[model samples]
Structures are given as C-alpha cells and as structure tokens.
Target chain A: MANDSDGIDIDYVANLARIALTDQEKERFSGQLGDVLKYIEKLNTVDVSGVEPTAHAFPLENVWREDAAEPGFPVETALKNAPAVRRNMIAVPKVVE
Target chain B: MSDPLYYRTASALSRELEAKKISSLELVRAVIERTRAVDGTVGAFISFDEDDALARARASDARREGGEALGPLDGIPVGIKDILAVEGQPLTCASRMLGDFVSPYDATAIGKLKAAGAIPWGRLNMDEFAMGSSTENSSVKTTANPWNTDCIPGGSSGGSAACVAAGEAPLTLGSDTGGSIRQPAALCGVVGMKPTYGLVSRYGLVAFASSLDQVGPFAHTVEDAAILLQAVAGYDRRDSTSYKTDIPDYRAALQENRGPWKLGIPSEYFGEGLDPEVEKAVRAAIDFYRKEGCEIVEVSLPHTEYAVGVYYIIATAEASSNLARYDGIRYTHRSSEATDAIDLYFRSRAEGFGEEVKRRVILGTYVLSSGYYDAYYLKAQKVRTLIRGDFLKAYNQVDALLTPTTPAPAFRKGEKTDDPLRMYLSDIYTIGANLAGIPGISIPCGFSGDGLPIGLQILGRPYQEADLFAIARRFEEAHDYHAKHPGL
Candidate 1:
C-alpha cells in the first residue's frame, strides 16, 4: 500500500466532499490511503460457512406505528428556526436559473 | 433542599420523584445549572433549552400536585443526542446539512421518554452524521472529555457520554452504528448500553448507517441505563426494523440475583494493539467478576479480526444510500448559486456534507456501484455472517464474551486526527457486536495511570441484554468503579 500503483484521487474525493483541502492535506491523506485499503483487505480471511448473512442485527421485520393521525407541531413554530425562508416555506437560493 | 441530591442514578431519581422528596422543577433547575457551568468546558450540548425544560418540569410538578401519577422517569432531565428527532426542534446530526432542518415529529424513543415524564433538556453534540469515532468529526464543535479537557470524548455519541460523565444529565440518549455509544461511554467513564438491535426503535433517528444504527442510553450507572431502556425499548410500528417481540421489564431482569456465570475472553481482543494500562484495567475487572463467582474461559472469535473491515464496508454502503436523501430538495441546506435544480442537488450535497461524510459517501458509492458491488459490498456481507457465526459459536460454549471497550483510554483531541486509519482502528474491539447485531455494554473497569477511565465491554447473545446487565450490575455492586467520579 504505497504511492506505487494508481494513486487514490484525493482531488476527486475533495470535489465530492466540497471542501477545499490544502495541498498538504491531499498529500498526507493520499499517502495514508494504502493503509486504509490494506486494513480492509485483512477482512477477506474470515470463513463464513453455513451462516446466513444479516443485513440488520435483528431478524428482518417491519416495525409499524399506528396510522391514526396525531397532533403535529404547528407550521409557524416548526418554521421558526429556518435559516432561510420565503412566504411560510423554507427558502433556498434559486438553484435553477 | 434536602440532601441536594448529587450523582443520583436515574432509577434512584425516579424513586425520589415518586416518593415526593424532590420536586421535578428542582431537579430540572439543578441539571440546567450544572449543564450551564460545565457545558462550556465539555462542549456536550449543541443546544440547551432551559426555558422549555423548566416549563416541562413545572408541568410535571403540577401533575404530581394534581395527584396524577407520573411515569417512571417523571421529570428527569435527559440530554437528547442531536441525531434523534425531537418534534419542533432542530435535528442537526452536528452537520451543516441539517443545520436548519426541524423535525415535524418526535422519534419513537423521544416520544417514549416524554411519556415516561423525562424532560428533554437539549440536543447533545455528535460526530457529523455519526461518522467518526471521536467528537472531532462533529461539524458543530468537539466534545471534550470531562476527565481531562484536552482529551476527546469518544463519539459519535461523545456529547451524550460527556454530559453524563460531567453530571449535566443523569442519562442521555445515543445511537450506536458501530461503537458510537460504548466507545464514548468507556472513554468518558459512564455506563453505555447498545441494546439488542431491535430493542429500541429507529423510527426518528436521522439515518447515518441504517442497517447498523440503533438508539441506546448512556447513564452514570447500569441500573439507570436499565430503567431508561425499560421505558424506551419496545416495538414501534413506524420503525420497520423495530422488533415485535415483547418488551421485558429490563429493571426487573437486573434485580434477579446472579451467581456463577460463564464468561468468555476472546483471545483476539487481548492481542496486540491493546494498550498495557487498558489491558491491566480489563484484567482486574475480569478477576473481580471471577471472584463474584463467574467461570472464566478462553474463547476464540476466529472472525474477530475481520470485524472493522466488514463494518466499514457495510456501514459506509448504508450511509451512502441513506445520506442520498440530503441532495438538498426536500430538507435542509441548499447551496445559493446553483444554475439549476439538478445543480442544487449536487452542489448542496457537496457543500453541506463534511469531509468525512463525503469521503464515506464516495467510498460507499465506489463499493456499492455497478462493477464493484459483488466484490466489495457482497464480500463484506459474507464476512459479516462469519463474524456473527463466531459470536454464536462462542456463546454456545460461554454465557458472554468480555473484552476491553477501547484500545486505550481517552486520547488527546488531535492525537489521531491526522491519521484516519489509526482513528478507525479505535473501533476494532467494538464493531463486531454491531456486525452481529448482538447486545453489548461498556462499564467502567478502572482508571489509567493518568486517571482516565478504562471500560470493559461485555458482549451477550441477541436479546440477552438481561444477562449482560445482570453480570455488569453484579460487577458494579462488588467493585466501586461506578462510585468514582471524574472530579469535574
């Protein structure tokens, strides 16, 4: 796990996460990528025989609450903390031109 | 002001509330004052609603005056983890994404707590979307350990653990994706229980990793946690993953006397990477348990080594999918200068999510995407089965598995921040239980040389929290670990 093969594109990850990482951060994180990948590789050795793969720790079951309508928070109070709003609705800057 | 009640367990507080010795308002006030004083240093709370809490406490007092019987936790102030939704409150998982997202409804756990007369004090801090092991990942602020201000409070439930340790709240609600609850609890010297996966409902918890996430309680004592769990655990129709099984009275289960019990020490847990001080503290705990009439045996969890690897793949995959909802349209933050709605989705998500979250999202997308799905995601699931099998195999021969909760005591805030892999390794001793969906608890064993707390984790079979609590309680009763405070 070194900078020997195709390096993990730190810039691509930074773009995905939207943070402007300093050059040092990119270099440091890039160098450490191999260790992360290598550690995950170690998990391949476990022998899973006759064991059912569990997506959830509990047996797959539906937890349903009553369908009856309950009183909800008033819209005025609910929207009180909105950082940005317009005409009783949470407003965000116009995304589509 | 009879006795000025300091360090009262949730159970004891409930008993006092029923006995009419302490008014709910007084308790609420005391907790608010304590939180105000220490929260500045601990950074436990992102938001503390003192006025609302007092209002609720006064109402509870009115109920008592009107001869209306209150619930078990009637008027006990509980710090809610920011990840759980509280109706009409901001449900920020310590991230900029949901900085303004208000929950229209209460989470099932919060509803249950309210029904039990537990006053919601405030939203505690946590890792952004419960991603990292330390509270440093929290976009809001880092939660400092009460024991030492410089050291980190283990996270993504770091604030919850810190609040309990600092005596700001007698009990706090936290969610465990991996060791989010147990690890922080250990580091902060408090009792944290990750109930059997389905024991608590996930109806209103903001999803981090859906498959692995479960809400649990953090408290100063095991009985306090048990009492809180009794009120919160049960089937919820809203949460499809919630169990339909009967909700047993966990408090009663704890009261059942215990004698000799089978305890398994997984060899892999005691191997290299464990700090010498943590090892000594855990060994002393095991010895104490043995003296309390428990049979200790060496057990092998052959797949234990693969736990962290399997957990990362599965948790990241789920996180990637679950977090897809944050594309800026229906809820929370949207970027200002997007050229179109599609750009809004992409730009908002890219800007709103923190670095760690984006890293995970990308990793998850890579694993679950078209070509690599079978190779990474499916393979990880197969290994997850083996990890569960290992637990089942060991449980067949022993009653419970005991191990150190963390590799070391609370580390300094910036110690592993630069090294992501080293930080991930901290969860090595804890991720297996989440993978296997078994119940585990972290109880304070002793302190390190520098006086930071050390925790011993006890893992039990699915739905065997009763046995785990019994063993943990017995150990607590015999040893004085719970009695020692951080001198905050």
Candidate 2:
C-alpha cells in the first residue's frame, strides 16, 4: 500500500488493473502520471463542502423493462470471436490448476 | 476546381436523388473513388468494403425506383466511427485487442441508420477505446488532418471528421466523450454535434465514460448534421439512459427558429492558451449574432479551469471499469504466453493496449483503489456537480453560449505526443458541455493563417438542439465557411 512521492503506487495500481507492464512502461507512466496527478491536485482549491456528488448527468433509477424471455445472439454467433471454443463455450486457461 | 459530387452535403445529395438527377449508386461510387484516391495520404478509414457499399447503394436505388425511399438520409452513405458495432463488420475501436473482432449484431444506432436506408460505409479510425484527443493513439494508423497532411486531425474521432472534410463521405458518426467529436470536427473544419446526453442511443457505442459519452454526427453543414441527427436520435429501450423527449424536426428548425435570440460569451473561455486566430474567428461570429439583433451578455462559468481534471478522473475511471470486459477468454486478443488464467489477463492487456490506454487505466485504478476512492473519485464527482451547476446558472440568463470550439487549430503531428497533459488541455473548451449533459455543436467558422480550420461552438439547453442548430445555421448562412473543403 506504500506509494511514491507522487501518491501513486504504479506497481500496485497496475497489478490491481490486472495489466502487466514492462519496466520501461512502469518508469515512463510513473513520471507521466505523476505529472498528471500533480496537475490534478488543482482540484483541491475548489471548495466542495456539502456538495452532492453527481454520478450521472441525469441519473435514472429503477429502469424496469419487460421481464420476458427473448432470443439473443445464438451461441455460435456469440462464440464466433473466441480465441478457442470447446463444446459451444469459450475455452480458457486453467483456473484451478 | 469545380466541386465534385463527393463533396456535396447530404441534404444537397438528397435533393438531387429526389430529382432523379443522380443515383445512390453513382454517389457511392464517387465517394469510394474519392476515398481510394486521398485515403493513402489522409488515412481516414481503417477498412472499407467497396463491393458492400455498392450493393447497399443499389438496394437504395431499387427502393427509390419502386417509389419507397426511406427518408432524406435514404441512399446516402454515412461513414461510421470504428467504435460502434456494425453487425458483421469490424468493430476495432482502433485497438489491437479487438483486431479480429466482428460485431455479432448491429448497435441500435446502426440498426436505425440501416432502417433509414443509409448505407453503413467504412470503419473509421479513432483513439484506441476513445482515450486520447489526437488519433495518434490509434493502433491502426494516424489519421492526418486533411487540410495539411502533417497536422494531426483532432480526435479520438479524427477519422470520422477527416473523412467528411476530405470529401470521402458526406456524413459520418462519432461519439463525444469529453470532446472526441467536437475537437476533431473543429480541427478538421466540419460540423460536429454532440447532442444532449442520452439524446442519441449509446446501445452500440463502445463506452469510454458512460455519463459523458454520447453518439453524435459529423457533417459538412449544420443542416446535414441535423439530418443525420434526426435519423439516429430517439429513445431506445435497450439504453436505459436514452431520454424520452419530443424529437423535433431539426432541419426545419434551421429556417423556422431563426433568432434574434440571446447569446452568452463565457469570459473564462477567451483567456490564455487560446490562439489569436481562433479568438478572432470566434469573436467575429459573436459580432455577427450581435449585428443580427441578438442581445449578447458576458457570463461566468467559474469552474471552467477544473473541467479537464474532473473529466480525466471520471472518464478514465469509467473506462477502466467498462474495458474490463476485454479479457482474453472471449472475443478480444488472447496471449499465448500465459501460464494460467490470471497470467492471460495480465499479458494480453499489456501486449494489446497502447501507451495512453495503459496510462489512463493505471491512473483510474489508483483513484478508484481502496484508500484513495473518497479523495479522488468522490471529490471529483462533487466538483463535477459544481461544473454542471455553473452551466445551468448561466443558461438562466442566456439562451446559449458561443465560444471557440478548440483553443486553437490542429497542431502538427508529434507536437503534443510526448506530453500527455498538454494533449488533454486541447479538449478544455468542449469538456464542459459533456460534464453538464448539455447539447453542443462545432461548426466551421474560419481557418488559421496556416490554413488549418477553426470552429465556433454553440452550446444549448438539454434537448433543445433545434435552438442549437438554428444558432449555428445563422452564422453558417452568413459566411461560406462550411462551403470550404480541405484542398485534399
């Protein structure tokens, strides 16, 4: 959980993002993102006291649709882009090995 | 040089088609020939099928011959930004991850375009996952500004704008999430409109920032933009966010709603970093409105400086979440160098994404991570509320705000490539509208001394695109800026 002086822990963040980065990327991004973070620090000047956070421009709630069964993309069509397919399902590397 | 059929506006082409003076087949061929001729230098399209486009044009001609034309857009070919799902066509988003991916079904917008008999043309390039301002982030190829081949077409919708400006297509569609559509449209000197959030369905658009992302049109004229907007705009049950509102006749609104309307000039937009030429052109546009009997007022949107910071946090945070669907197991790129399931995810993404994408994903993950969530993410949302409030407060005094679409015209390629922060500032003016969920349009106003195009932006109240179009049309008709095409 320890972070660099820029307040960003690139290794930890990249790991959490589940993307492996080369050593060069880690260095380059750390410097670039550090500069960006420094610029973003300007947000601290704005007083947001008691201000409500807006998650959406116009937040919609309880958008209910008909709960009826309808045809979707056929399994073959859905699996058309899979790297590997077996028995009509996407095949993946072993998870529990 | 005389204007070719390829450079005609969609509205003009529609009139000629109705008069039977031209066939959709002939028009499509001209566009295909134009694309083949200039695309070598412009690099506007990632891929296009001449045979498929020709066939669709023939179908439109057949429908017209039988006295059953769909609409004004019927028989016109519209270039599609590669991010949208065009069923059975490539949907790359200009990224390596989906390099081989073909859409299984049409996006709601694409379906609507097809229903209008508008042929879905080529796959236009964009910033990989619509993450960058310049199309340079595109893994495919950089789309050059058609005006000057060395300058970058402002993007992630650069290809969409460049195609129309280069006369390759009369109309095209681009999604604006923090100025993706407007900036490029401004840089490329075409009419690019980002409708009120949820005004157009996002069912098929690849999400970057869900709240900020809205699909819009890039066209040669304000009226052409209106025509394209009319075809694909409306509520879709599939996209819960698609607002249910009265869809007006935007083209008719151009002539009908001619105004002696009130306009505002936000003081913050005219400050430093704005190029002199861009300022001069936009100021001239404002003076035109004043001369036309419209009351002009100086307004303040105090949170203008904070827009870019707020956008990067919110947009990248959303992008990080949305792009999680691109795991190696499914349709996206798979890594052969994986030892296990977890290894596959890491290696595939690391290899597939470009530098900017990785940077944003990392920044997003950090801000949303456990300890920093409230500090960065929540605080940004609150600031976002303030930004939205600033625009609404101004709207009470003015009908709409007029400003420079971009701080400057298109810059030479590689100028800002090394500096990501500098690149983000290029979207400074257009981001406010998206954050506020309001409608905004960028129309060709004038050109820089270097001959690059500059744009004038007009922002309107939510769902009031008629007024927005009318305001822009006033200036468009006053001058022949929209009539000027890139010398490509």
The C-alpha lDDT values of all candidates are 0.84, 0.92
Candidate with top lDDT is: 2
| lDDT tens digits by residue: candidate 2, B18-105 | 9899999999999999999999999999999888899999999999999999999889999999999998898999999999999998
Residues B1-488, candidate 1: write the lDDT tens digits: 23235467877888888889889999998998888887888899999778889999999999988888567788899889999989878788999998877778899999999998889879999999999999999888989999999999999899999999988989999999899999999999999999888789998998888888889999988889888888899988777777778877777888775757989999999999999999998998889888877899999998887788788789888987888878666566777867766667767886788877876776676567655676668888888877887899999999998999999999998999878778888999989999988999999999988999999999998888888888899889877777677766
TM-score for chain B considered on its own, for each of the candidates: 0.98, 0.99
Name the top DockQ candidate.
Answer: 2
Say which candidate scores most in TM-score. 2
Among all windows of 10 consecutive residues in model 2 chain B, the one with the lowest summed lDDT is B1-10
